[model samples]
Target: MVGASIANFTEIRGYIKGRAVLGKSATEIFKDVVDIYGKGWMSYRTVCRWAKKFASGRVSIENDTKTGRKVSISTKLAEARIQELLLEDARYTVRELAKLTGVSSSTVHFILKKQLKVRKITARWIPHLLTVEQKRSRVQCARKILKMAQKIEKNNFPDLVMGDETWIYFENYEPHRKISNKVWATKAAKRPCIAKRTMSVRKMLYAIFFTARGLAIQVPVPKGRGITGKFYRDVVLKKLDKYFGKIQPKSGMRHIKLLHDNAPVHKAAIVTDFLSGKHVTVLQHPPYSPDLSRCDFFLFPRLKKILAGRKYSKRPSVGSAIYQCLISIPTKDYIRAFQMWLKRLKI
Candidate 1:
C-alpha cells in the first residue's frame, strides 16, 4: 500500500510537470485535476503547491529525505539538559527552550515528548499561591472537618448552609465563553467579531446563603459600603433568621453548620457574637483555601458561566440575572457540591 501511494504521488507530480511544461497556470491545472480525480483525492492547495514547484523547473518528483542524522537534540546528554532547564523553569515556551539550547522548535518538542517525556501544562488559577504554612493549615483543617463530618453522619447529617460573597461585574463576564451563534462558512469569509471588551467599573457585591437543598437567600451588598461585620450580621443574619425562623436550624435536624472563608468581616467580634447569640455552628475553614469553599469551587463558577456574555446596565439587573441563574440550578448540583466538599476534606 505504501509503495502504491509513492507510485501514485510520483504519477501526480509527473502529470503536474507535464501540465506546467504546456504553459498551464497553477489554478488551471488545479481545476483540471479536480475534474479528473475529484476533490477527495487531493486538496486544491496541495495541487497548486505542486504546480508551483513544477513551474520552477524542478525535475525530482519524489519528496526530499525527511529523516536525517536523528536530531542531536534527542541525544541522552541533550535530553537531560533540556529536562534540567524545564525543571528550572516550567513556564519556558518551545521557542524559548529552542533558543536557549540552539535547537529547532520541532527538535525541542521531539526531545520534550519522545526523549524527556514532559509536556507543558496550564496551571489552575487560584486566589493565592499558598505557602508551606498555609498548605499545612489546610491539611489540618481538612482532617478536623472530616472527623466532625463523620461524627455528624453517624446520626443524621446536619443541614449544611454554605455562604460566600463574590463581586459581580455588570459588564465584565467570563472571557472564553461563546456568546454568539457560530455557523459553517468558507475559509475566506470574515469571522464575526464576538470578542469581549475591557470590564466596566459598574459592579456589585453579591452574596448567597445556600444549603444542599437550594439557595436560601441572596443579598446584593449596597454600593459604596463594603461588607463590614455589622452589615454582614444585619443583612445575612437577618435573612438567615427569616428563612429558618428565629429559632435556627429550620425543621429537619438538630443543628445547622455555616461554612465560610476566614475573611476579616466573617471573623469580626460582632459576627462571632451574633453567631453565638443565634447558636449557629460556624464550620472551621482554613485561611486562603477557596478550593475547599463550596461557592468558590461550584456555586460561583456556575453563576459566572451563566452570567458570561450577559450585559446589565444597572446593579439591579445584574442581581436579577444572578438570582435567576441561582434559582435555575438543579437540586442535584447543590447536593453534588456538598458531596465533593466532603470528598475534598478526605483529600
Candidate 2:
C-alpha cells in the first residue's frame, strides 16, 4: 500500500500534465476522470487502473499525452464547430458532445463553459403554449384582481376561495431525474429508479378548496362523473354550503372572492349564474397561467412530495395520507403564498 502523502502529490502532478486532475473520493473524482475521457471508458475501472500505477510510482496517471487530446478542440475553428453542434441540439449531453465533436469530453466542456458561457437547464412543463394575446390578457387580468383586492380594504383581506382538481393515481410516477452537468459525469451513472407497480386501475379525482386560513374541504369528485357545469352548481355548491352556509357579506367584503382556472366547466354560463346567485365573486384568471394559480404552484406539489413512494391499496388510506399532509402545512405558508400572489400581479 502507498502512503497518503505520496498519492496526493502524484495526483496533483498528474492533473497539471493532463490539465484534468482528479483526487480520490472514489465518486466525484471518478466522475471527473470520466468527463475528461469519453463514455467509452469505465469510471471505476479506469480509477483503479490509475491508483495501481500511482502505487508503483508512475508520474502521469492519465492514459495519453495532453497535446494529443487538446489539439482537436482548442482552436478557433473547433470552437465554431462546437457552437454549431450545440445550436443544433441544446440538450446534447457532455459525452454526446465529445463523441460528436471528436474531442475529449473535457475539451467539449471547456469550449461550452469557458468559451460559450452557456449552461443547460431543464425547461418547465406548461399546460399549453401561450399566444401574445393570451399573455396580454394574463397581465390585464392580474391588474384587475389586484385593484379588487385593494379597493375593498375594510376587511383585513377578503375571503379567497381557490379550488382546483387533480387526479391522484394509486401508483405515483417517479419524478423526472436531472442530468448531471459535471465536466465528465454522464446521465447513465446519475439517474435514480424506484421500484413501483406500473399498472393500476385505481385512481381518484380530488377537488380541493382552500382559504388563507386553511383547507376549506378536500372532496373526492364522484367516480365516473366528469366535472361539468351541472356538477359545479349541484354537487360543488352543496359541498361549499356545508362549509360556508349561505355566503354572507362580511366587513368591507360583501362577497367572497372565488378564484379558479379557465376550465370549460368553470366557464359555463350555468356555473357563472349559480355563483352570482350565491354572491361568490369569480376573480379573473389568465388562461394557462398555472404559475399564477396558488393551488398549482404550492398545494399540489407539497401534497405530491409527501405522497411520493407511499403505497396505498385503498381510497381511505390515500385520503388519510393526503389529509395529514395538507393539514400539516403551516398556516404561515398559506399566508406567504397569498402575499406572493399579490407580488406576481405587479410583475
Among the numbered candidates, top lDDT falls to 1
- The C-alpha lDDT values of all candidates are 0.79, 0.72
Model 1 vs truth, CA RMSD: 10.3
Task: Give the C-alpha lDDT of model 1.
Answer: 0.79
In order of appearance, the predictions have TM-scores of 0.65, 0.61
Which stretches in model 2 have alpha-carbon errors above 4 Å? 1-116, 119-127, 151-156, 170-199, 246-254, 309-313
| Model 1 collision count | 0
Candidate 2: tens digits of C-alpha lDDT, residues 132-206: 999999989987887776754334344777889987877665542233222464767764455553445577888
Identify the leading candidate in terms of TM-score.
1
Error of 2 at 281 (Å): 1.5
